[model samples]
Target: MPEKLTNIRNFSIIAHIDHGKSTLADRFLLHTKTIEERTFHDQVLDAMDLERERGITIKSHPVRMHYDADDGRTYVFNLIDTPGHVDFSYEVSRSLAACEGAILLIDAAQGVQAQTLANANLALHQKLTIIPVINKIDLPAADVDMCLEQVEELLAIPRDEVLKVSAKSGMGVKELLEAVVARVPPPETDPAQPLQALVFDSVYDVYRGVVSFVRVVNGSVKVGESIRFFNTDLTTEVKEVGYFSPGMKPSASLLQGEVGYIITTIKTPGDIHVGDTITGYLRACKQPLAGFQHVRPMVFSGIYPIDTADYEALKANIAKLRLNDSAFVAQPESSIALGAGFRCGFLGLLHMEIVQERLRREYNMELLLTYPSVIYHVFMRDGSMKEVDNPLHMPDPSHISHVEEPMIKSQIIAPATYLGAIMNLVMDKRGICLKTDNVDHIHVMITARLPLHEIVLDFYDKLKTVTRGYGSMDYEPDGYETSPTVKLEILVNSEPVDAFASIVHADRAVYRARMICERLREAIPPQMFKVAIQGAVGGRIIAREDVRQLRKNVLAKCYGGDITRKRKLLDKQKEGKKRMKEVGNVNIPPEAFVAVLRASDDKG
Candidate 1:
């Protein structure tokens, strides 16, 4: 290898949540003295307050460090920190595409987990060099031998090659770093080639325009260079080129095999794509690098402003958020009951929640989200197939031939003792167990196929409940399967509430309808006239709940009135009440929608 390429190593840490990926990165920053001890903090790479508060890495952060090895040589290490949640696996994949190697970190106490296996397979699929490392070895329950056996059995890596380290206590960290230097190979590319930098991520800057994080695969990019995005064919001038000192440290240029950022003149939200390739305008690469796959959101919901007048503000906020997150998709969709809103799609339930929280916190916008739904492939009798994510878009039952819902192949790792409970939980979610394998003496791995709709709700919470918080699950799309489904709509005073409608499985529709109706009964305030909340499938009503009217005492002060007069007064009051009921519209509060969403997550 040439001296220039041999001194630079690009690698990322891949692991399940809470497996100390961020902590390990922190240790790397400290050991290399990238930051002074007095200025350092835990989870240094997790810059977002939400990330620090949640104790999870939501975004993949890259930083460069100069380390002095025991061999009396200095090397440049580019470490990309990635999120562990399945929803952000796209972030993991993008970060991995920019790296030449990955540190496959496993929790010593938890051993091999579902996501552990998932991330390992991703790295393997990318053909990247994997360094198996056991983390948290200082814990009392750390079973090094069991973890080693599981890694060898599941990941097919030899036990002798695995390194053990305590990221929290800094034990064996130095040796682990040495192993990374020795095991992970250097980037192999020629600087003489045409400029072909892969854009892994980008964030919209109010002042600097779009700041794109890129990995220069070949040639180089510097300030004042005009570049074109291969995906969109949009040309822009580079305003600044810098590498992350963990902070933006401007450099003269970004060279080949280096990970850095390039600030462009473009200010639009959707101009530069995350996985797009950047090439010089006059002299471009013949072909763009193989970028990451485009993200397909699995869950869809309606996001509306709590205050109708905030619609414009909400739209701007969502667009800004989308600039940071390409996976989160939104389009203008209005609901009669909820007014103007956006139909937003998310990778999963957690991803939806995180986006909501970010909007509320960062943008200070009060938002309302409808019941989440998955895209269904509806095959019509005329041999036409239509994709439906919103219940409002569902065709009439008579026009539909069959409905096919998305399915997922799920992997669950749990204690062997919880097998029966876990199996029963899966069964309740309309899942079929395919096979099971023992990871060690006490832990077992279970693979199952389940409808995506069933698990979208409270499946994860229920799995944790049944397994006593010992079970972890990871899943991937497994195409679609024909299923009996219907559009379930909630009607308030005989008027359909578009925001509360959903496409539910026929077998579970009745249960889900009843749950939502009950929640509405509790949430909707009583009016002068009675309000009826009904859940209906097409024209048939399946569940109903009535909000009792607040009756007024018309005869309270008629103690001395004649019987006929009193009777006349009572009749007049009845007429007034009837008139109010006929003309009045039910007002569904924000809390009512929130209650219905909470109820929608109940196991059906």
Candidate 2:
């Protein structure tokens, strides 16, 4: 039987990256005896190998736990563990929307970082009760008092009300569980109302089809019932209804205010979307629940199989991956240099990296990724607008009036010692400083508006370098601004290599061109004839480099022969080079294209 609505507590844990969010979830699982001590491992909720290796959660994982509260009653707790990185903020928002409260985890030694402020604001915006907790207190360098003060000052939460727990050592976990039961209110729902379940997340299993993870808000759903998706308007019979006991366990029905998974046996992944409302077919909901806002991709890149034979396999894998990751978008695109591929859009740089890594590791495929870019709105001379997500799709500069690049509101939190370096770096990236706040005597937060393209390329790595790894950053889309931009095209031996072309600010085009040309010079091997690598904007060349021919001296065999013989050999060699330059096509290695993406490594 389903537990009483009053006994169900649905909540999530939100925190900055590497702030012990997963570790805390592990403690909760152990405290409630959800898993045997012998079977328990580190970061049990982070099932993905990538998440474990990176020490961060990429996807939000939901698990149901049963706790015996101090009030002499058993309570059902649904814990949604959310990703901490800014790229996964949309996932965090959806998880928060499905919860009644959120546990704000902060690292005691690190204090409040940029993502902490961003996620806290998200929880407050959703009207969920915020419970601040300072984790990792067992460390020798842990500064609990300082973190507490930062939380109070930044989040406006009371100091005394904040809880303390060391998730690693299991200290104060029992009390923390009790506080959850007492402080976090149970879900509010009306069983008499029509069925309306919020689909927060979903996954596609080869055996079971689409399994939607939902939080039932009103009414109830049972097996063999006909359900309709509010947005898609597609109806299907429920194959199964179940709750997550860390893993899926079949249940007869899911009543109001409960969290569980639903198996609809729907094959097409697009039919069931995250944030869609599910209702009974017979008595459908008149108004669907307030679904989440559609997430837009902030970074774009081209992914192609190293061998064209795997093109179909790559496409199929991407379709399957999209069944679980809705934020990823891919469209078929063809490149003269890279062959058939897909132009993919991502939330951020890390998100792009994660997807690429998954394609390689999970799907066991060899792939080539083009340089990442941001979408640009090209205003044409004919008063028409074209959105360019890939540099290859960039319109000719002569036919375009101007280009508008996406901008973002960036926030950086770091030690006060690196404030000058951080400011300098931001200004160099064409960022406008909005404001800066001193969290305490030791920590500071900087807010700025920067072009999305700048951040997509090596900004995070540079930030960590300047701040000595003590800094953290978060950003959100801040619309777009018109800018003077041009397409920088790379030509090898007078032939345009579309893979190396990029859209850059006009002011920085010359510098970027020079950098890419120099990189290509090192990446391209010497050929029989000199290859001129030029970076051009429309009809004008801005930067150039030449890979000198590999000289095989035919004249070396002359030895002490007369000057006439040597002259003949030299003339023949020169003619051969001239002919080669006219007809020889440069064969650029795949690594050359990859090197172009990292051309700014030293400079950045």
Candidate 3:
């Protein structure tokens, strides 16, 4: 069966973060009559509440739609949505590889951003048919023509190729769809080959397990057929097969030139690989497809449980959570003090957020997540162990001779007027300025190489503030370099507060310690019993604190009918105490913990 390529259009929506990709996806879904008009209000593809609240597309979504043209010819549209953040760049590449074309959504006001250039270049690299669309024309600050001009200049594409449509107003949307049908080529559909599909994205449903969202490349799929994930030897019978028109819609089976989902009954993320192809007959692939290995896990983190009590639950939840996302690699990890935690590997930061959020939201598990750190190679005396996720577990110089801290090629775009401020900010964050380009006298594009650790300094908010919301960042892991940095442990009453341990460039430990104390004073609550906080290099405390009485209450009045009020007051205090962390007889508030965690940030 040769695919109905003339009637098929396979493409994806690509854009910068919050440029309205998901919103436009919903509008397209509505136009295609795939979803009800009034159902989805926010990001439709951002099915997870965390994604919607965070305002980021954490995963790529594959959907199928049918559009009835004015010419009365019905066309099947397969739209895949990709994550915009630099963290999910690998995932985005995979998505782009799967699609023949991509819709570049640009905010009418915020022209071509770093991501805009990055994703567009990715599309161009893959030879993906690119159609530029100007979104948010309804925005008061929208400079639609200017944005269109920028896209043309950036890529040297024709102005007519760009579609100026406001996804919000439903204006110019039909024309955008028409552009898609005309410009983007359809998928190659030939059923002579076995049923093969590329998994762009997947999610774990407790009832369904690993429901792999796939874009079929060749052949056909049917229920009760033996199938296999090419990367993993695991094979299972296709228990159920369905198609997605944004929402999961039941289908008898999907053929070539179709996008659908299949439930393998194999319930684990390890069993599913993103670029892994699916075949009708098990072990049918002669060789696995191309562009599979480019998606390397870039960022690493030591994910721990707050309470040792949650250890078992944490392990169980992570295992269950991995059933869908193949990008997550959780290895059994532990610390003498932190008991048990997973050295979780992720494609990027949003991948981390999705994993952590899924654990809490779906599995109902509590997570004590440490700062995300990359794997650093240390050449040790005996041998070498690749340090993954925990800076506290960093091999000392006695254990390791040399080290490599992962670096990122970071690019930020902002108003040209703020170039000096951004330059100072990036330089302060240990960034090596590569170059800066002025965008039409108003916007500035700055490129730099920065250690991934340098970015954990709460620069996201500060970047917005410094650039007056005119700046945006896009970065990808570049390479690793030898670093002379060391960790400084902050101890509270001789017990290492796991969350309080901070990492630094190691030159200014005393300055960091004093700053940690001041920040802790702001973060830690006034306590009933005086507690001492010490920032130490080894067992010696360079900085220390002695907290005084917080229970100095003057109970001057004891009214006759105020016994109930006093009991309620006591109960309220008890509730407050319950909320406050004991922290070795020291009641610490949550804000205090975060404040200490972020105390070393570049505030000036």
Candidate 4:
């Protein structure tokens, strides 16, 4: 192990979405000359195609760089880039746990957003040194003075001390890098102690198995040493150890206070979980690191293959993906309408969308996803309680007591002009306004307590619409609350479809049911006979819509016939229609299952 741990700095960039975090990271790489100018690209840390397309970072990327400061010394800097979306806040937390400091980036024009405060709080809770940096000063709308005042006001840092950088033009980047080394303290190392590495993140490699990203806090790890995960109790010999020079490169060993990757050739990604502690088998640490909590999936939905024959393949692919992503959970489930499939749980809607996109793009499989739902606690009449994530598993209302739904503490930052619209939108989703604060005369921050189920739907889109894309929001689990709720089921031609069932608050059930019925009426094709689309709560029908049958040519063939003959023909056609209504099946379009998600108006 190196004796001079003071030469190393471990830090991450914490910022709001579209605040030029990835761009700053790119500037850092360029300043250090880590990658050649010919090979340089925008958002290099964002490796996924989806990330590049969406202009966001979906995964946490760690890279090591060497920078020569004007102080006559070279330093090793480990920069961990994190995702800025609320859906990946846990990822930010894990990244912060591995760093000793964080570079708090705020847009010069946009100022500090809701996520900026949320991430700052997270970094402060970790006892990390924060160096405030204002980015994108090159823009015409840039308000550096205003941003500096806001930073000093919110972060309590002196206005003149905060660094300013234009990540795109490379202005002030050198000073920013030097500020990281001068302002942020190096990791405290104790190489003589037993091995105690914190596994902050992990990813799967088809050829090498599970690659664990760790910060060696106490001792060191080598390729031939036997290591055990404190959480899983699984022991294995390290196949390889390396550092990310933006890409994996083999290293002899990782020392104390150094961040690197360890390959254990562990086939099951679930076994080598994130937030686990890694220690040498011969000299294990006395206690594991703190803040190690298993990720609980908040939102869930059913995912079935478009073709039934791909069911087994989809299951296999999910298992493989789960090996890499421990936050994603799936269990075997069967639906009458969707057939054999799995009920998958995710951190949020964005996470769910990413997983579905990966399944389609990486695995080349088409899928049908049911409406997203949150976990519900059901109390039964027999003094028993069960937690249900899938609406299919919901118990009968007759045997159940009241239900409780998950709630979240949400924060929104937007222009004051949209305050009324935003509040109305939130309240429509059952959100209770808690408080409001003025960041400046033009911007305001609103805090609210809302049902998690509501936010998992189109709440975000509605928020964006109401605020004219100037608003950003972040949320955390605020616990659960008891609400009058019931599972609303959709039936087509008197047959219930489990895929269209949802547990909704009693006050909104009628509106939601009507919306679903109306949407189904539009999505379902006209049948030979009238088809009844009904939404029911238990056995009581709450909303109904009928699809009128297509007009037949039964009377068209009767040319100049007697009136009695025409009546007989019409009577025969009516009798056939009655028989068809009894025996005919309604073939619902796939869009009908997701119609509730498209319900935009409150009237329903």
In terms of lDDT, the best-performing candidate is: 1
Residue pairs that clash (backbone atoms under 3 angstroms), model 1: none
Q: Using Cα atoms with residue i matched to residue i, what is each candidate's TM-score against the true structure?
A: 0.94, 0.96, 0.84, 0.95
Q: List, residue by residue over 35-131, the lDDT tens digit for candidate 2.
A: 8899988999888899999999987789999999888999999998888888888778888889999999899889999999999999999999888
At residue 573, give the lDDT of candidate 3.
62
Better of 1 and 4 by TM-score: 4
Better of 3 and 4 by lDDT: 4
| Candidate whose TM-score is highest | 2
lDDT score of residue 569 within candidate 1: 88
Q: Candidate 4, residues 1-604: lDDT per residue as tens digits?
A: 3536889999999999889999999989988999889999999999888888887788899999999999988999999898888887877888899999999999998998888999999999999999999999889999888787677766788887888899999999999988998989989866567999999888989888889999998988999999999988999999999999999999999988889999995877888766789999999988898878888899998898878899999999999878778899999889888789999999998899899999999899988888788999998989998999878789988998889999999989899999999899888888899999887767888999999988886788888889988898989999889999898999888999888888888988898889889888988888899999899998899999999898677778778958998899889989999998888777777666555554554631
Q: What TM-score does candidate 1 reach?
A: 0.94
Which residue window of length 10 is worst by lDDT in model 2?
595-604
Ranking by TM-score: 2, 4, 1, 3
- Model 3, range 434-476, lDDT digits (tens) per residue? 9987655467788999888777546767788899988888887
Error of 1 at 53 (Å): 1.3
The TM-score measured for candidate 4 stands at: 0.95
**For each candidate, what is the lDDT?**
0.89, 0.89, 0.76, 0.88
How big is the RMSD of model 4? 2.1
